[model samples]
Target: MNQSATRLNTEELNLALNLLRAGELVGIPTETVYGLAADASQPEAVAKIFAAKGRPADHPVIVHIAGVEQLAAWAQNIPDEAYLLAQHFWPGPLTLILERQAHVSDAVTGGQNTVGLRAPAHPITQQLLQHFGGGLAAPSANQFGHVSPTTAAHVRGEFSEEVLQLVLDGGACDVGVESTIVSLVGDKPKLLRPGGVSREAIEAVLGDSLEHHTNQYTAKQRVSGLLDSHYAPRTTLITGQAARLQECIAEKLAQNQKVVLICQEINTKLDIEQFLMPSSPQAYAQQIYATLRQLDLQRFDTLFLALPPNTTEWLAIHDRLARAAHHRY
Candidate 1:
């Protein structure tokens, strides 16, 4: 973290809230990524988020509220499952999709009748929302389609000296990945995205009868972070089995291509560049984006990645990497 980066206090919080109230952007921390937040009700303020991140206007942003009590204000006809999930995972990283209230701006929902909403569990973020007294539409604080930022320095690196008036530094995010987005507006509990909150966890709270949604790449409910070619590094990425990955890396090296390999275990004695993440899923999820962000800066010819095990625990990480490597198709 930069020593000189403005730290959050009561006074700084007030200043950031003022900016948000005035329809300006403020980088607020969440359990997932630091988000570029703007008042969700203000179409102009929400537009600033898309402009700041260079995000496509078609992609929707998640409306983050202070707590579950405020859900009805932004989302209309809240389902029973929404309340159940909120009771279990509010003040945490789990976004619920429900029909939007008439007042909820179409800009925030990308013109969809349903809106994605969540109450992030970061204290500074909650305080900022409570002080601002409104829902904030926030997307990851980075250039669109790039790796998300997990720390304040990451946010600063993206917006160096660009007059980003306020950033609430809440240290590194705990879940590291984005929220598990479940849509309850349909007939059953439909999952829009796999995130830090695993399906098993949700199933444990709900039951096996809960329906899991697949990534169909549809135009109707185009959510943020679910695009085919997103969360990518500047360099090309290849993901697969370890032995085959080693062979592919060697082939790349034979072609005089500089490469970096990211894996859970550094067992292979490959002379090329390599990095290892913790074997634990939680720790790996926390560091995955940051590692990719760092390696993306090296300007390597390609990124040779080891495929994570085909298990439910690694679903979110795999989903992200798969999207990052979509161009290989």
Candidate 2:
């Protein structure tokens, strides 16, 4: 790993902010994942992000703002639901879909009338945005349809030698998964995706019965993570009950298949291969991405994942695991 490519500081922040202001790309840290950030208000800078990620033009970027006050500046007709959600979840992993103000770029919104906006909880990101003095149009700091990068080193792995100017290393992400996406554009509140924030958490803050509509990703929706095959690892991922998954692992080992087992605990002592995550939910969430990234590099033929516990707290982990495994609905 290049030392310069994976580290940044306050001085680097100023330099990166200058690059962003001048319509150049910079990799930024966030609680969710590292993002390839550009000035959201600049069309040219936003286009570079899509080119670097090989992301589709129609796939919208989340405009990250410094604070809640800036929300009204970019988003129009902010609803009561948006306000409540923002008050509770801002500076965290929660992206809200709202109607775009006239001045907001269609490029940032992917030609949609509405745009996705977030106030990330990461201090480095907040400082960079505050210095830049505008929203940043950023997507996950990796190639499109690839596993999102949780660490700055992971971000550098995506680029060739000189494409990326700087990667602001802020260690591993706290929320290994993306933000919970809620759309406030419609009459009723809808969850576009389940993530770090639970639906129950959102309801607790709203203090009313909220209707959740299932808007399956269509060609027209252009929502993030809507693609059927995404968040994948190089190795084939098989998911099932812990016991059954363990059995599968044993069977594969008997056949001398190259297999790696990932779970919260390892009961059966199989010497073939295994990775154990912490038993607690918070610990599990924090380590999920880094674990998978490591296992993916080991040249394993298949990955056996023990299904996490069925509980609200495990929702985000389950979602990311299911996507990585590419299980049929």
Best by lDDT: 1
Q: What are the TM-scores, per candidate, against the unseen true structure?
A: 0.93, 0.91
lDDT of each: 0.82, 0.80
lDDT of 2 by residue, 195-233 (tens): 778888987887765454333342235667756666777
Q: How much does candidate 1 score in TM-score?
A: 0.93
Model 1 RMSD to the real structure?
2.6
Clash-forming residue pairs, model 1: none
lDDT of model number 2:
0.80
What TM-score does candidate 2 get on C-alpha atoms? 0.91
lDDT of 1 by residue, 7-84 (tens): 468688778878888888888888888898899999998998888788888789999998889999988888777888
Off by over 4 Å in 1: 1-7, 160-163, 216-220, 326-329
Most TM-score-accurate candidate: 1
Q: Lowest-scoring 10 consecutive residues by lDDT in candidate 2? A: 1-10
